[model samples]
Target: MDNNLTDRSFWKAFWESRIGLIFNIKRDYIFGDMLGKIKAKKGYQTAIELGGFPGYYTIYLKKYENMDTTLFDYFVHQGLVNELLEVNGLKETDIDIIEADLFSYQPETQYDMVLSFGLIEHFKDTKAIIATHLPFLKDNGTLFITLPNFKSINGWVQRKFDLENYNKHYIESMNPALLASYCKELGLKDVESYYHGKFSMWLENKGTQSALAKAFVKSLWFTGKVFTKIFPFESKALSPYIVLKATK
Candidate 1:
C-alpha cells in the first residue's frame, strides 16, 4: 500500500480502537436493564461480546457483575483493544480476546447473556446474527442489541447506496417493529426497545427535509433532555439507534 493508504488505515484502526475503548464504555443504561431482565430468568455465568471494540463494555460488564467474561473481535483498529485491556490493568489471560472475525468462530458452550451493542445493524443478514450471535444465550438468556435506524433522511441515504459492506449489518436505518420481528425470530420474548438522550431522539424524525437539518440536530443534542421531558420516546421518534431487550 502507498504511504497515504497506510496512513489512512493506521488512523482508521487507531480511531476504532480509541473510540471503542474510551467512548460508550458507560452502560447503555437503557439497554443495560436487559442484563437485569436476563438475570431475572436464567442468570449468567459466562458472558461474551462478539465485536468488542476497545473492551469498554467488556470491562464494564466484568465489573458490574463480577463476571469473568470473553471479548471477541479481530481488533482491526491497530492494537487498541489490546492496549485498552492493559491500560485497564487487565492481563492477557484475564480475557479471551479473540483477534478473529466472529463470523468464522463458533463456540462449544452456551452463555446466560449475549450482548452485541452497536453491531447488528452493520449486517444485512439478520439470520446470520441469529445463527452466530444468539446461540451464546443460555435458555431464557438475554440478548441486547443496538443498530442504526433508517427513519431519517441521512440514514436513508446511507442505506440506499452501495451498502454491500454492511450486508451483515443494517448499513441502513432500522424500524423498531422490524427489529422486534428479528428478536421474535431468535425466539426471544418480552422484547422492548429504548433510546438514549434527547439529541439522538430528535434525529430520528424524518425531518431531514428541512434545510436547517444541521442546526436542528445541534439543538436536539444540546437540549435533548428538555426535549425528552417534553417528548419522551423522542429518541425512537427521531433517531435510528434503539436498544432491544429480549428474552429467550
Candidate 2:
C-alpha cells in the first residue's frame, strides 16, 4: 500500500464498494477476536478507531458494550456513517464521528483503546503510523491492530489458486514476533500478537468477486468449512489474519 495511493478519496470509495480485490470486510471472527481482547483487559471505556469506515466495528463495540467511541476517516464517507447509524437504529449521540486524514488528525483527549484493522499494512512505515496514534491513547491504553497474514498457508492458497484475491496493497505480511519487536522499540508494554481466522471465512466473504473467482472460492468452500469444524483449532502460523495488541 503506497502512501500516494492511500489518499482520502480512495478509501471513501473503498468503504462504499466491494469492487476491488483489496476491499475486504473486517470479518466477524476478527471483530469478535478484537472484542475479546478488549474485554480481557477490562478498560474499554473510551476508544477510537483509526480509519474506521462504515464504522461497523465501532458500532459493534458500542452496541454490545458500554463505551465512549469515536470514528476517524475521510469526510467523503460520511454518508456511509449516516447509513450505518440508520441501519443499526442508532442516533448521533451514540458515538462521535470525525472526518479527516488519519495522519493529520490530532485528538483533544486520549482514549482507553485505539484500534485499526487492515490499516498499517497499507503504509510503508508501519511504525510511524503506530507512533502517530500513541499520543491519542491514554496511559496504559491498548493499541490493537489486525492485518492480512499473507505469509500464511491461506495466503499461499490465494496466490496460487486465486491471484485476483491477492492484491498489491498488501505491501508486506507481518508476524507476531515482528509486531512485538515494533512495540518494544516504541516503548509499548504487554505486547501480544498471534493469528486468527480459518480458511472457511475466506470462502464465505468473497465479496463482489468475478464469476471465475466466485466459482473458485465456492468450489473449496465446503471442504474448508468442514476442515475447520473437524480441526476446531486455528493454526498460529497458517491462519488468514495476524492480530496485534500492546499497551502504551
**Predicted model with the maximum TM-score:** 2
Candidate 2 structure quality by residue, lDDT tens digits, 1-248: 24533666556455556443222233363466557567666756888888777676777677666578888865436655666666666776798888776676777889888888877776767677778778888998888888877776566656765564455345454667877788899999999888777654363135546788777666666667777888766675446777888989
- Whole-model lDDT per candidate: 0.58, 0.70
Tens-digit lDDT string for candidate 1 (8-82)? 344355455332344334445444555655554565667788776556666666655666677766454536655
Off by over 4 Å in 1: 1-30, 33-37, 40-42, 76-78, 86-89, 150-173, 193-197, 201-217, 223-225
- Output the TM-score of candidate 2: 0.82
Model 2 poorest ten-residue lDDT run: 18-27
